[model samples]
Target: MTKLKLSFLFLSVMSLAIFVACSAETETITKEVEVIKEVMVEAKSTLKTVQDRGTLKCGVNDNLTGFGVLTSGGTFEGFDIDYCKAVAAAILGDASKVEYVPLTASARFEALSSGEIDMLVRNTTWTASRDRDLGNDFTATTFYDGQGMMVYADSGYKTIEDMNGSTVCVLQGTTTELNLDDRFTSAGLDYTPLTFETNDPLQAAFEEKRCDGWTTDKSGLASKRAEFPASAGGPDSLVVLAETLSKEPLGPLTRDNDSNFYDVVQWVVFGLIQAEESGITSANVSSMAANPTDPGMARLLGVAFGDGKVADFSFGVDPTFIQNAISAVGNYGEIYERHLTPLGLTRSGSLNALWTNGGLIYAPPFR
Candidate 1:
């Protein structure tokens, strides 16, 4: 063969091999791009997920007053509901953008575990078993309560011991149920357990005298007592026994495996208490924001300094988020007064008071 013919053949083969190699490289690049896009789509945190969803799904109690209750106007009201609203304000920038799911004590955990609700704001107790066993996390205790028994004031039973052989009505799926059994058995008292699935039935049975006593958190008993029928001798007809059964440290709950969402919730709640401690209220929040001089206050409200640098704690929330929440619902104390105070519950000298005043409602510093 001629030298030119041989050289031409070799060049053609080289070109063909280069074309195949480039085609393979392009195919690999396309696959990697697709994978990266998929990872990006799946990498969203719960905060972002909630933002995209446009509302916070909160699990709450629909039966109890001073904590959670549905009114005749078809709206949720009370302490737990306010906390849900405050959380919604902080995260979604609108307190009204919330879906309140009324749940029973037995159903609250299941709703949270299954992602049916983003959070549990019902008066749920934080137990060691619940904390360690369930794939969930508990934030600061919002309300400090204890289990107690309620009976007719004229029932002639002054104490739990005096009620031996009496039938007590109680919710079936709650810490109250266990406490009732434990206290009665330990006290060597014989009492019939009238278990109920929900509060309506329990309240109905109690009103109809189907049970001699009603057992629940002391705060719940107060709520129920406030609604006692005039035909049943009015609210004074029911009296809560003084025996404290269990420490019901109630609070909000979040699911596990999402650290960002947890941090957001934890800090927002603590911030409410902190705001109250700082004497910041909805009425004066605007002035504080406009002329923030306190380092902590300025930092919390995201006030820019002379150099235009605002404090960044990396919480993934707007600096104005806490202020907005406070403005919408006031601080924790305001929330309590608005709902609980009317129920004949006082914060002073109680477990729900501030830490400075010898109570458990305290907050961590923003710094």
Candidate 2:
């Protein structure tokens, strides 16, 4: 071949090489952009926000007996208060590092939506409207409850049907209100509904006989009944009716946009229930995790993976977050008994019972 023909062939090959390199570089750049889009930087913002604040701001009821009520020391105590501590324990590793925002039923969702609080665990029900319209996400039903009527034992009202056309007091802006209305109307009973913004005045009015019956979540009634005084015929005076009006599955509440935060709160809830089922108490967690042979238990307790790699679920939580949380707060049943049992609430035969016991309280597998 001539030298000119050899040079022409070399130039064509060089041109093809340059074109392929440019196309490959362009494809690589496009993939980099797509990966950046998928990373969801905003999802990390919630964890960062809580960390920066140095405390989790929890919204809670100021005066619901079993769920949330302030002690003489001004510290809140109840089933709801324990949950707030669990979230803090999971996020900050210190259960006490929390700013409690006491909110009325009407103000709880507003506070959550406006970012005034990190979460609301104020015995709020998980309803279709709140889940879809309130721009908030509900995670795990921490407590299973039902709306019911609370009447003075001597009021001659043995059942809900006996109280028709009577005056009933209930807190406004709760499922209890709507449930009460529906129950009475469905039974073709005409009753007067009196509303309160909080439980303090609502309980006062019932004790004062301002209303013939007080209606709210049955758990709330039990808590209030536990606190009743001898002047008002004591706790035995008020009886929560046998008929449960509506289902109330209470749990953690966060803004809908914070999906990462949602996962963190939800798993924290699941962690408690799972801990109970696995027989992994706070006492046994450390020993169990030191070298758990069970794959699911190892994953849940962040024990040895039986492989060299550290167990990481990658749910924007610490590998040992469940351990920290469960250690700070015991399993779900323990928390309930600690705060709610004194209120005459029991887990047996209720929806709050474990799934193994024929109830709805089952947690998904951690593995």
Candidate 3:
């Protein structure tokens, strides 16, 4: 063949080869794009998975007063109940969109891990074992509590040391029981633990003198004191021993791996604490939103726009989600006063106070 004919034939073959290579590359890219789309779809499916189900299923205690009490009207109340409301308000923008599943102490964690509830807020203690080994995440502590023993005023017991060789009533499947055992054992005091599943049955046994003492969180003992039978001379008839056995940072918890949902639950608690810190209560949240000059407050209330909209936090919540939460359920302090203080529990000198006040209740900057 001539040189010109040979060059033209070579160019034609090269061009055809380049076209096939480009087509193969395009097919490979298309398959990758399809895979990415599937992953994205699966991810988005998890967003608001609880809300899409139309109710926030919360695991709570059925008997512990001032923490997770079920009233005679079949309604749940107390500190844990308020945090559940905060979660619902933050996610659904309506606090009442919650279904409380009253769980026993032992059932709380399993209920959460099994997806029987979206969150557990049953005055659960956040321990390393429960957080790491139980496959759950403790968001934030709403209440700083410590275990104590309660006895009838007439019993004349002033300290745990006085309870040596006495029978103590305790709730089963709780850190309270373990703490009671450890406190007594570490002090070389011999005491019998009468464990019961529910507080009602336990209280009944206590009233019947089945045990010489009742051991639980100080706040819980206070709550029971306020509600004790008037025939038993009411709250003044009982006394909480002036000793705290263990640090019980009771808070809300969710399943692990869902960071977005976790943030929503976490910040609901933080928002309440932040609101209390900023002097914003349920009664004043609206007015503060109307004239929010503080950057932190504005960002929290979704009034100030940042590099991204406030909702860019990707917590599966609206920008003003916290504002809604505060509006629905009061701030942390208000919740404490409304539910706890009435039961004779005090906030002073406890871990539940604000960090500025030398307590552990601190929140991250809203920004």
lDDT of each: 0.84, 0.83, 0.82
Candidate 2: list runs displaced more than 4 Å: 1-44
* Top-scoring candidate (lDDT): 1
Ranking by lDDT: 1, 2, 3
TM-score of 1: 0.87
lDDT of 2 by residue, 36-114 (tens): 4334444335666897788999999868767888878988888888888988999899999989999999988999987
Q: What are the models' TM-scores?
A: 0.87, 0.89, 0.85
For every candidate, C-alpha RMSD to the true structure in Å? 12.0, 10.7, 11.3
Local accuracy of candidate 3 as per-residue lDDT tens digits, 218-278: 7788778878898867778888888889999888888876567787888888989999999
Instruction: Give the C-alpha miss distance for residue 26 in model 3, angstroms.
Output: 17
How well does candidate 3 match the true structure in TM-score terms? Answer: 0.85
Residues forming the 10-long window of minimal summed lDDT in candidate 3: 38-47
**Which scores greater on lDDT, model 1 or model 2?**
1
In model 2, which residue pairs have backbone atoms overlapping below 3 Å? none
